[model samples]
Target: MFITKVFILIIIASITNINNTSALKLECTYREPDLHWEAFSRDYTCEGTIRLDGDDENIRTVTNTHREQMRNADVRGLMIVQQRDLQKFPKGLERHFHHLIGIDFEDCGLTKISSDDLMPFKELLQINLSGNRLTELPNDLFQFNPKLKKIDLSGNLIMHVGLEIFNNLQHLTMINMHDNACTSDNAYATKKEELKELVWELSVECPPTLDMLSSSLFGSKEFIDNIKRISGEDSDDVRNELLNEIQGLEKIVQELKRRL
Candidate 1:
């Protein structure tokens, strides 16, 4: 009887462990890649779009499987939506979707994006990052994506627009900037002649000099907080050092302007 009881207990423990492992596994469907219309341009083509929609864990699993299946596909666009658990932009996507022309991360919980996140999308034409938790955009966010034509940044928490952000983006004709925290304005170029006016309007809404300085020097408020946490008592010294660096950069900029 003692031996039988011990066997039963072991079996129960094994079953419990199996159940826990199954519970921890993310559940998602791996559907075959379909020829769908691209979200931004509404173009119908087999290689136009790949939609990945789920919570972060499920999407991650699906993305991995899809990447394998679409390894040889000439994928031109990607859309990831309803991902509340996705706080940062998924890196290394350009590895598989190098030919991607448009990317949509709508309704995701993305809080921030860096220049490096977009550095690889050189052939990108349009981007829709609406309905995210983004509070600010990096200064060089679009530096590498010079071929970009359209941008949709509506429905975010962004409060400022930097003048330098749009520099050299001559091909950019439309910008959907409505419903952000800063102002309810949309910039559209009806004709080539009107594009300059729209661009100027976009630049004029930039945050003040002090705010721009903070953003340019530190990248984001969260980064400053992280530095404070890591440096602790030396945070003040670190901040002063950064300010001095900013001053030096300003002097260089002024000299360059004078020379030009």
Candidate 2:
């Protein structure tokens, strides 16, 4: 009876530990003005993540050391490093900022983004490499963090987004190539053609199992509200105007469909 009781107690302890471990996800918030760090800056014991909105220009000034200070203060969640030209600095320093969902480097002049620059952060959510000068990204770029959501490659000098670039990134949502030189009339026309072909090929190989749209798809709440002044769900006048334009497009589609 004593031995049986001991085994039961051990099982109970194991179950409790499992529950605690599962429940220990972290939570963090962007430090707001006036509210500052005090409101969201506890000992970082809360569970989930931290988000640095892409518009936060202050992130550019934050050094890896200062970010390390934030990490050592017991904050172990998402740290969104927005638009900092990390590659301009020496290598290995980026490995230090590996505490969060991922870093956003959109429009940060990355002519060459490698997987080595990203290998340290094992728990990355996604990394935004959009609007860079990268002609090619490493093949196994997403292999390290397969949970990657968005890889926005819009406005870059990329000739072609490789077919295998996204093979491991099942959770990837938006791969933006809009407004790129690749899409221009002058360059990468064939590669862009190949990119479109690959999208079609991949769609056939695997139907998209996820809805991968980022929150940035729609502008910020303030911008969306401003858009409402000109065009939104609540704006009946704007809706009517859009409906009129769509009505015109609908006529064109009808004619095309009839021709088909």
Candidate 3:
């Protein structure tokens, strides 16, 4: 189903002819397998231009109007094509989209996501954010969504990742982050200390599940270069627990490599 959405967006981009600065709009519609366009009228557009930041009053009005129109409706799914460059995740999405099961931000140029605004998407199952420009995620970005199953962050500029972003996500099974800077030595160097802190955190907290240990995220050479940062601690118990965590992580990475 996500692949079908990607194909639709590719077709829309091929047909859409706009100057870079011209404002583009988005609206909600359900598409069948035949790919029907249900509504393209102005009312469904919510009088909003897809943008990250602009006039505060205009932004509020746009989001509020959307909230009013779709209030209390069982909006199971939604897909928005910015059809233009939006430099960040559209604000106020959390206030309006409550029952969303899946969302996509393909090719929309989002640099970062809002940690606070995502609190409403507890039931959200899938999130496809491929082809954005995201650099990092907030530490508690996934705090509200424990049941989330799949996340696709492939084809982004992501470099830094918070330690707690993957914590306690027991249901997450698939995460796609291929072709990002997180695996590169230079980019990992920028956050080497931070990554070490995450590795050290395993002594007290429940280590993230084996599936969440994808190397595309934590596999940079610089990360392994400084992997022994916590070895100097005096407590052998702490060192033993850390060593166990490290072995589990290495095993996960090896499994991932075998699959490739």
Q: What lDDT, from 0 to 1, does candidate 2 have?
A: 0.46
Q: Among all windows of ten consecutive residues in candidate 3, which has the lowest summed lDDT?
A: 34-43
Order of candidates by lDDT, top first?
1, 3, 2
**Each prediction's Cα lDDT score?**
0.63, 0.46, 0.54
Best by TM-score: 1
Across 141-253, the per-residue lDDT of candidate 3 in tens digits comes to 77887877666676777665555676656666566566675533221211435434433442123233333345434554545544555555567776676677678778877
After the best TM-score superposition of candidate 1, give how far the Cα of residue 218 lies from its true spot, in angstroms.
Answer: 13
What digit string (tens of lDDT, one per residue) describes model 2 on residues 16-116?
A: 77554433121334332231222123323222122233332122222222223454333333332333443331233333333555455556556776566
- Judged by lDDT against the true structure, how good is candidate 3? 0.54
Q: What is the C-alpha RMSD of each candidate to the true structure, in Å?
A: 9.9, 16.7, 17.1
For each candidate in turn, the TM-score is: 0.58, 0.42, 0.49
Candidate 2 TM-score to native:
0.42
- Candidate 3: which stretches are off by over 4 Å? 1-26, 33-54, 57-72, 82-84, 184-260
Residue-pair clashes per prediction, in order, are 0, 7, 0
Task: State in Å the error of residue 161, model 2.
Answer: 2.8
